[model samples]
Target chain A: MKAAKIVFGLLAVTFLMAPLVTILPLAFTSSDLLSYPIRSFSLRWFEELMISDAWRMSIVNSLVIGAGATLLATVLGTLVSLGLRRSFAFSGILKSALLLPMVVPAVILGVGMQITFIQLGLVNTHVGVIIAHTVVALPFVIVSVSGSLAGIDMRVERAAMSLGANPLRVFGHVTLPLMLPGVLSGAVLAFATSLDEVVLTLFVAGPNQRTLARQMFSSIRENISPAIAAAAFVIIVGTVVVAGLVLLFRAAAQRQKPSTVTV
Target chain B: MTASMATSRASGRGSTTGRDGSMAASSARVAAMNGASAPFIALEQVEMMFGTHRVVDQLDLTITRGEFVSLLGPSGSGKTTILMLLAGFLQPTAGSICLGGKRIDHLPPHRRDMGVVFQNYALFPHMSVADNVAFPLRMRRVGREEIEQRVTRALDMVQLQHLRDRRPAMLSGGQQQRIALARALVFEPSVVLMDEPLGALDKQLREQMQLDIRDLHRRLGLTIVFVTHDQGEALTMSDRIAVFNRGRIEQIGSPTEIYDRPASRFVAEFIGETNLMAGKVTTTGPDGSLIRLDSGEDMAASAADWPAAGNEALLSVRPENVTVQPVGTARRTERVNIMQAKVADSVYQGDHLRLHLDCGQRRMIARLDRQVADYAVGTQVDVVFQADNCRVIPT
Candidate 1:
């Protein structure tokens, strides 16, 4: 039974990693075109990617836009989660509306944002793309932060207040520190969301603001060069590095967690 | 509100005739009121409403400085609500609260300078014990050196100074309780409110903590409002106990007064074990009264605050007070109130043997000495009740 379970798990993992496994080896091909057959293994496509200004500029834009979107989404989502902690008549509706972004179709959101940004004179700009990415990333931040917030005993806040810490101080000292794990994970999720965003960037971003994903999209449509495969490899490696660092930090934090004191 | 307020207060009055009765209770209360320079905390007609559902209704109480008073009640009886109201977590919809002769209901919890030890301790998990105790001091912007000194002193009070560097999650239940107590007391707020602070511990530990808290209360001269549903804990630690029912305080008196002469049926049933028999008042005097039970048995009981002679009454007697004498040839003549009963069952309980007896159509139980041989079922026995132990409560 255990062997069967292990076999099924391996099958699931293989299914998930199949795309990455197929795309990763093309970057090592000697031929200019991305195909199965390779004349020889070479670093020519990587060199091409490094020398091209468009690819380098796209990487920088992606980083800048991702950071900006993450900052905006994390702040807004955290504030919303905190506000939602206190119950009110319309809180249910408000929470549902805020979380609606997570379920909305990306193409619909992209088209809606495009039309809205055009009238607001924010079209073809970094700010437009960042805002679009933030709209999508905000739901992840809210869900993660609210989960952490819900885990905290509300009485702890009251205890803080009774112990002479005002509301602001209570948040600064107790609530924020307790919710750090959630906030960190949420910020990382927002960053990843912004980095991987392409459909919204295509609708709103200009030539000057083309992100790495947008450049990759254009490269796929224009040509089947192995440089695109090289870019894919870099993107995959970069994502793995970021996620690995986050998981390592989380594990360290979990190790420091004290044993249960039932009292 | 005024009418209910009068009833709540009157329930504690006019019952000065128990073994440890009214005179001492009134004196203790009077001493508490005049003992301090002023009543440290006063709640006047405090009404708390959650939406339309009233949680606390026109509750009026005054706690003198340095007094240890307990609010005792079952769950949802509004005792904890009063503590939260005093701590400024819940706002009273209609009344005023004053601390140190100044109105404080308008102030937020932090500004009110009241400390609370939560039922679960609520100690900050991320902080070391010293930091947890220093949190209040830090918020008040106390000097770093002073905070260090006071933290040491607070931990020392709870005998937890050696565990100062340990995190709360690493401590035992008792140690965590002490840390929570230390944190609450470090700031030395005007009043300390503890909500079932010892409820989580085992029985033995709870008893030890009860004594420890009472000792600290005396030594530190702290004005404490303790909330607990455990009647024994309240009786052990409190100078006075306010018994609450529904959303109002049913009675408030010293522990002995509450136990010996409970004001109402609720207090009698809630405080201790009592065998209550429905009766009608037949004769009343200054010292005692005579009641005829619904079972047609006549019983002599201590005088209670009854409306009239023929009105309904409840005769409550503790099991320990009911002596069971085996039916014999001559020894039963000296007993004043005696009735023939058949032993339904008898169980040995280490220190005492409980005799469950049936007298006519009524079933009663008596807690007898362990030295007495157990009476077998269906054996005839004589159950005696002294007038001092039998209390007649007016309905």
Candidate 2:
């Protein structure tokens, strides 16, 4: 039974990652435009990617928006989650309302947001784009933070309070530390969402504030070049790198947890 | 969680009233007594309501300086609710709680100056033992060096210092509980509350932890209010045990008193196995009274305040105190209280024999030491108990 499970596990990994495996090698193709079973491989595409001003700007744009969205989503989501917890009067209703951004089709939210932004004259600015991304990011933060909140034995906070610390101190100390990993993880996810956000960005983003996905889309419309493939490859790599960094940070953070982890 | 121990450590403040040596002594006394104060913790006529139904009724209790009190009850008893009230997690709809003479009922739990331990230990799974112990101290803002020193001391007290660097997931249940104990104590809070901290352990481990917890209390002299549904655990470790029922404290006393002289029928039956035989007072005697059983037998019993003549009462008899004799034993003398019985069944448990017998219309069990040998099931026998040993409780 164990051997069978191992076989199935490897098969599943291959099934999910095999497409990326194919795409990665195609990125090195000398002839460009993603032809399978590359006839030749060279470093020209990598060099082309390095020299492309458009690609560099896209990288910078994605990072900035990812960071901004991460910061906004994490803070808003964590606060809302904490408020929602132990305040059930409107939390249930409010939580469902907040989650509508996540479940609603991205195009619909984008359309509504576009109209709202046009009225407010925010359609062509970086800040407008960030707010839209942050809205999508917020639910991830709330869901992550609140998931951990439910795991916390409420008794611990009470225990702290009875010990002498006041309410804010409890939040700053006991409650906050325990829930941070979930919060941090959520922010990373929000950053990932914003970084890859193409559907919403297509409508809400200003031409001057073009994101990586938007840049890639425009480049694809114009023509397929080896640099575009290189850029696409770089994007895929960037996503992986960001995810890896989040994992590393989380592992380090957990190593220093105050609760007993080892036997 | 405390950033420093001082932040979460609620002061009794009574020492401030005294000067010089008296002040030191006052602080020392409170520390010695269990960091308790003049009515530091109060459970005022507290009631817990679930819609219109009251699960816990009005309860009034005051825990003084340095007392090790255990709330003992069976499942569904309101003992846990009272502990929650003291912990500031549950608000009483009708009453308020005062801690250190300040109203704390409306205060959130973080401001209550208490340390709590749950049955599952509630240790953070990602943290090492030392970090877990240091958590509350950290929240209270104790200096880093002091936090380390106290964490070390607390860990050593529980004899888990060697495992301090290990995370909670790696420890055994007993070790986790010990780490929890250290964490609760490292902050030096005024009171520590434990809710069935040892309930998850096996019997042997449970008993061992009971001793360790009691010893820890002695060494630290920290005031604690522990809740457990186990009667043996309560009697084995508590300085005083409060018997709770439905939602009220039925009785409170030392182990001996609670065991030997229970205050009510609920307490007597709840604490241990007892043979409750209905009896009625027939006449008053010098020391107590002459009672007649519902079985139409006259029995003499000594107790304070004889019930009115023919008033119904219950006789609480422990199985260990009940003796059984062969049908022809001459030990059944004239002065002895003997009744004819048949041994309906006998269970042989190492070192003892449990004999179930039927005497007249009442069922009685006698726990006889192994030396007495075994009585075959269905054999006729004579049952006996000393008059003073039977607690005749008025119904």
Candidate 3:
């Protein structure tokens, strides 16, 4: 049974990783045309990504939009979670409504947002793309932050108030510090979400506001070069680095936790 | 503000004296000033309702300055609710609270200037012990030098200065509890409210902390309002105890008064283990009353609440007050009530023996020293108790 289970797990991992395994190595190929077997390895495709005007512009756009969306989503999501901490009669309904963007099809959200953006004169702008990305990223921030917020012992905040801290001071001194790990991880998730978003960005962005994901989509249709593979590699590595930082932060937080032994 | 600061500085200096010598002098001063002035904290007709479920109903309580009062009851008995109301965490639905003769019901918790110690210690995990102790002073914008001096003195009060640099997580439960105590006292608030602060500790640690807190209360002349479900803790640490039942106070008095003369059957059963005998008063006088038990026995009980003739009453007798003797060993006395019974069971405790006696249709228990001769099952014995030890409580 154990052997069968191990075989099943290997099959699942292979199935999940097959596309990344086939595509990532092409990023290092010397050939201009993307091929299955690499004749040689070179840094030329990566250099093309950095030196080409359109690719360089797209990468910068991705970073700008991702950071903006992450900042907006994290602030709004943390506020919503704090407001929802002490539940009211409509709290469940409000929470479900907040998370509706997660379960709703992105195509539907894109169409709706595109119409709304047009009415608000936000279409074909970086602000439009960032706002679009924040709509989808908000749910992840809310979920992560709410999980950590729930884990906090509210008595600690009460203790702060009893020690002569007003409401704002208590939040700054106790509540914010306790839930910081959650906020950091949520920001990372929000940035990653905005970095790779394609459907909504394609509908909302113009040619000048093209993001990395939109550039890669057009490249796949028009050229299919190794430069596209380099962009993918850059995104994958960025995500891994961000996730690693979050894990390090979590480990440090765990170390600072008090020991549970009763004396 | 200047006058209050001077008084606080004076008390801070008083705390620096030797523990033994200062305890005597401070406690005597406290006793002398206890009831001579108005109450330090007063709750008048306070009612707290949670969506129509009344947690505290028309409650009135007063704590004199320098008195340690414990709100004792079972869970859901409104004792913790009272503590929360006093701390300004939960506002009473109606009525008012006054501290130092000024209405404070509308103030927020931080503005109320009261310290609260939670059951789980609730120390900031990210802060060092000194920072936790210095939090209130920092909040008040004290100078850095004064903050350091006060934090050091507060940690010294709890004897935890050596662990000032450690986080709360690195400390044991007792150490964390002491840090919480130091943090609460560091500000020298007008009142200190503790909600079962030692509930998490083991029995031995709890007993030691009880003595520590009682000693601190005496030495510091602190007015503390403590809430605990443990009757023994209240009896040991409180100057007066308010026994709560069903969102109301059943009885409130000194420990001895509440124990020796519980006003109701609930107070009698809640405070300690007592054998309650149902009876009707046959005769009553200023000194005592005669009651006829339902099990066909006549017993004398001291007067309680002035029970008139033929009123239903309960006779409460502590187990330790009853003496068990061999059937023919005890002689009848005028003031002692003696009954003949058969030993149904005997439980050997470490320091005492619990004898279960079957007398007619009722069962009575007597706690005797372990050195007393053991009685076998079905052996005849005499159960003896003085009339003064048996309290008559209204049913």
Candidate 4:
């Protein structure tokens, strides 16, 4: 039975890893077109991804949009979580309404936002795309921040107040520091959401405002450029590095935590 | 939903004072005459409401300057609520709070300048002991050098100077409690409020800390308001205790006055172990009163405050005050109230032997010194109650 379970686990891992195996090696091929079985190894496609203005501009757009969306989502989500933490008559309903964007289908939201952006004359603007990304990214921030907020014992805040801290000072000194880990994780999630976003960008973005995901989608459909494989490899490696940094940062924070003393 | 909120608000300041506001004023006047020039902290007709529930109603308390007063009660008896109100965390629905002859009800928590030691310690996990103690001074914008000096002095006062660089979680429970105390005192606020600060420590540690805190109270001459449910802690640490029952101050006096001359039945029962007998006042006099017990025994007792004759009364006798003697040893006299009782159970405590007696329809416990002859269960005994030791309170 144990051997059968091991075989099942390996099969699951292989199924999930099949696409990466098929695509990763193609980026190293010498051929201009992304064809299967390797002809020869070359660094031409990676060089193309770096040197091409269009590709570089798309990467810059993705970064700009991701940072803007992340800032907007983290600030608003944290405020909403804190406000909802206090008991109020409508707090439960308000939380569900704020999370509605996550439940709605992305295609429907994209179409709706496209129409709204056109009427507002924001269809070609970075602001339009960033706002759209923030809407989808908000739920992740709220969920993460709310968990941390709930974990905090409110008596600590009361203790601060008793120790001569005003409300704003208490938030700046105590609440914010305690919730930093959750806020950082939420911001990273928001940035990732915006970087990988394609459907919403396709509907609302102009050629000058195209994100890296949108650029890759067009490359796959129109030309199957080997540069696309190189871009995908970069994205995969970048995500891993970002995630590893977050883990390392969290571990450092954990180490700074006070150890319980034995009598 | 609104109804529930209203209900909670009312219940939060829940209990009504049976004797009314005038009684509180009289008590405050009495406290003011206890050698203090003026009342340091005065709560006048304070009422707290959570929705429609009254958690604290028409409450008035007075604490003298440099005196350590403890609010003693069971859980949900509004002792903690009173502390929160004093700390400016909860606003009174009606009436005013004054500190040092100035009204402070309108001031915010930080502006009030009162320090509070919370039940759980509530030390910041991110800061070291010295940093935690320095926080209040930092908020007040004290000079950097002054902050360091004060923080060092406070840590030294708690004998925790070596651990100043350590975080609170790195300390034992007793050590953490001392850190909390030092942090609260480092700012030198006029009044300090403590809500069961020693409740989390072990018995030995709690006793040690109690003495430590009492020493601090004396050397610093600080006016402190302490809240606790433990009667023993209140008795040991408080110069005076305000015994609360259902959010109302049932009585407030010195520990001996509360133990030996309780103002009400609740005070007598709550403060210590007692044998209570239901009776009626048969006669009233300047020196004492006569009561007829429900079990058909007529007992003479002293009453500081007389209830009208024929009114229902409760006879309160401390277990230690009741004397258990051999059946024929007592020289029966009218001056001594005696009863024929059977020893239903005799418990051998370390310093004393406790005899649970069955006297016909009533039960009484007598705590006898260990030097007395041991009375086994089912032994016949004569219980003697001196008139001076028994108090008659209107029920």
Q: Model 3: what is its DockQ?
A: 0.49
Candidate 1: residue A11 lDDT (0-100):
100
Local accuracy of candidate 1 as per-residue lDDT tens digits, A1-263: 99999999999999999999998999999997899977799999888878899898999999999999999999999999999988899999999999998888889988999999999999988898889999999999999889888878888888999888888889999999888887888898899888888888889999999988899999898988999989999888888887886686456445445433211
Stretches off by above 4 angstroms in model 3 are: A1-5, A257-263, B1-24, B28-36
TM-score of each: 0.92, 0.84, 0.94, 0.91
lDDT of 1 by residue, B176-222 (tens): 99999989988877788999999999999999999888766654556
Candidate achieving higher lDDT, 3 or 4:
3
* lDDT scores in order: 0.84, 0.77, 0.87, 0.84
TM-score (C-alpha, index-matched) for candidate 3: 0.94
Q: Choose the strongest candidate by TM-score.
A: 3
Candidate DockQ scores, in order: 0.43, 0.31, 0.49, 0.38
Q: List candidate 4 stretches off by more than 4 Å.
A: A1-11, A33-35, A249-263, B1-33
Model 4 TM-score (2 dp)? 0.91
lDDT of 3 by residue, B41-113 (tens): 8899999999989989899998887778999999999999998888888989998899989999999999988
Tell me the number of clashing residue pairs for each predicted model: 1, 38, 1, 20
Residue B122 in model 4: lDDT: 94
What global local distance difference test value does model 3 have? 0.87
